[model samples]
Target: MKLQKLIILFFFILIGFAGISQNIMEPKDLIPANDEIVNWQLIDSVNTYTDEDLYMYINGGADLYLEYGFNKLGSCKYRNRLASKIILEVYQMKNDAGAFGVFTINSSGKGKKIEIGNEAVQYDYYLHFWKQNYYVRCASTVKSEGVIDTLQQLAKQVASKIELPGKKPELFVLFNKTGYPFKQVKYFKGQVALANIFNFSHGSVAGFNEGISGKLDDKMVFVFSYENEKQRREWFASLKGKMNMSMLFDQYTTVEDGFTVKDRMGIMLSFKPVGKYILAIKGMDWPEAQPVFEKTSTNLP
Candidate 1:
């Protein structure tokens, strides 16, 4: 009986150690001391949520985090001398790519980008930034120099505490920057998101593994990478076969290996195959698109 009891005790000890090690990467070090900042005080205590549990905080948006490999969410509220309050939410995604995914989803689409963490953006009342695997948000009820300053100070402090590799996705660099700038680029991994943004072969026909889009002066540039050449050919075959029989518009002009279109209202879309990827430029002038397509094609694997 004593021997059996000893074995059970050993097993429990091992389990306890495993539990502690599992949480070693969590942002336990991000909590600010009571007097850490001069003008702000913690509303109560730093709160934490995980995965589906985040629904309590965000009724309809928790699913988006889960889709992007959300790990944990650490949040806190603060109040100032002027009775204004700020809500700070720090989301720890699975990786830098996933962090950027959530960041792009929440951004206002128009902000004066700043340099606080790896990539920081500011709005009139709040700030959102991502560093490594963390995407953080700070929203305030009041707007003033003091509010922005305090929020930034806290962000910088927390940023210093979070420890992780600061590397962005490698695929992001493949996007041609001819006329596209920082704000105009977006990376997507799932078909649902792609369909929602720009409906092409839809959620299934495209068979997209991952893709990136950038907006130029005259057109929206879309590049989709499939699993392999076989799948790419399959999807392209479907698109090409429909070129002649289908009627989404009245004007269909065949380019090198792809086709171009203009609707009754004069909207244009052009498609071309580049290596194992497909480049689709909508509202593009045929001649101007050639050089852009060639440049992007040369960069692909």
Candidate 2:
């Protein structure tokens, strides 16, 4: 009888560990349980998607997620007694950097920054954040009573369920030095996002690996990173060649290891290539942007 009881206890311990593992491994488990949030109930089963079929769900936006190294997605809907509906989406990216990249692009820069997860932003009808390798969004569809509050509540619950913490990319340090607000920064790896930032119109020159764009004191700063010095030089040469030949740019001038040009909009821009990164500042002359250029260049990884 003693031996049988011991065996039974061991079996239950194994089961307990398996359950914990399941909760950690499944992204869908990030959804708030019906009892987790007050008065809001999950309306249906969580929907899961992978890289192979994510397009069926998000359509045109799938490419953007894929560009950020998408892994899988889990989403669900919730309803409250007042008939308000909230949709929750948890995107599991390949890594923390990928998750942070997606969050930066998806967020509206004007949203109220919050502290629910590793980073969070709250809009009137939605709340989103990135934690660990998961990017979570909670959006309310109806403007019923307390709907916005519930949306944020639900987002917080989801964020708390995420067990690990996430770190921003290494390139973010350069932008940090410029005093750019964290919520206003954008990070990306490919042309899809690059086009949305400031269009150089030349699509992915030099095959750059990662980039950061942000605003500081009415000036726009851009940093593009390459795998090596060779690619950085190639990009610099291509951009310089374009500035010289393009009718859209004027007042092309060359400075020490860099150049300056004014676009058709008359916005003066400066560009400097240092180490494995290329730095550009819009709305600032080379002389003015040089200080910022050197500050960021000195911090390059």
Candidate 3:
């Protein structure tokens, strides 16, 4: 009876140890160091490589935030002695957040690795022909099992297609009639569009005024049109529930014969207070007014 009890206790202890080992990620599972083509050097931190180091190596860049406990990891280089065919990355897991992890291969021939922890997640990988004269990195949480693989594959694809541009894009600002700044806008000539930030005001509004005839998503816009007194009153009434109180206009005025029309000449000005800003929209259309309404609704002080 004593011998049987001892045996049962030993069996339970062995099972518990197995369970613990399975839960704990192993070094081999993190990064496979045995591959001949791929070489990995575990470094202490990310700052180990300097600008000079990056300049010296043709295929060298740093992979940071690997492993759950590790705050950061250092630079890595892939030497294509034969020819540069593929880009690879090797990383390690750091902390419980699973935000930091290494990139490596597995026995199933999968070409990526992830470090998942309780709080954070990280992606470490290499690119084939990266531009921008700096190492590219994307940091986010490890929310799923295949996230690492997805990121690694994306990095590979981006690196392969990267071409260094000759010059960078320029920035431009747009203003409304009242001269209040708008926070969100988009500018486009044809199919190519660029996002921008703009603000609105009471009488005058400014935004990306050009290439705004069509629809947009989550954008702020301003429009100017001609309307008669009655038409303008109806338009203002239509905006009652849609207008944000905090951004409503303080006052408005109407002008008779203000502009030339075939049969009639009249104009109206509707002013609304937009916190520190204000806005005036003439001949508001549903599509065009939507952005303005949204911006005012979520107005930022």
For lDDT, the strongest prediction is 2
lDDT values, one for every candidate? 0.74, 0.83, 0.30
Candidate 2 vs candidate 3: the lDDT winner is 2
lDDT of 3: 0.30
User: Model 2 over residues 1-301: C-alpha lDDT tens digits?
Assistant: 9999999999999999985564354678778788888887888789999986898889677888999998899989888777778889999988889999999988768889888889988888888899988898888996555777888888888887887778799888667965546336899989887777777745624478999988786788888999999978887898788877777778899998998888889999888998988898889998898888887778787
lDDT of 3 by residue, 25-112 (tens): 3222222222432322222222332323433322422222211122222333322233222223322222222221111111111223
Q: Is candidate 1 or candidate 2 better by TM-score?
A: 2
TM-score of 2: 0.85
Please write out the lDDT profile of model 1 over residues 1-301, one tens digit for every residue: 9999999999999999986455335653575655887788889888899878888878685777777788888888888878889888888887788888667666656887888778888888889888888888888888877788877887888777766536666567767434346345767777655654566533433666777777665467878888888888888877766654455554678877877866445768778876678887877757767877887777777
| Worst-scoring 10-residue span by lDDT in model 1 | 196-205
> Residue 155 lDDT in model 2?
81
Clashing pairs in 1: none
TM-score comparison, 1 vs 3, better candidate? 1
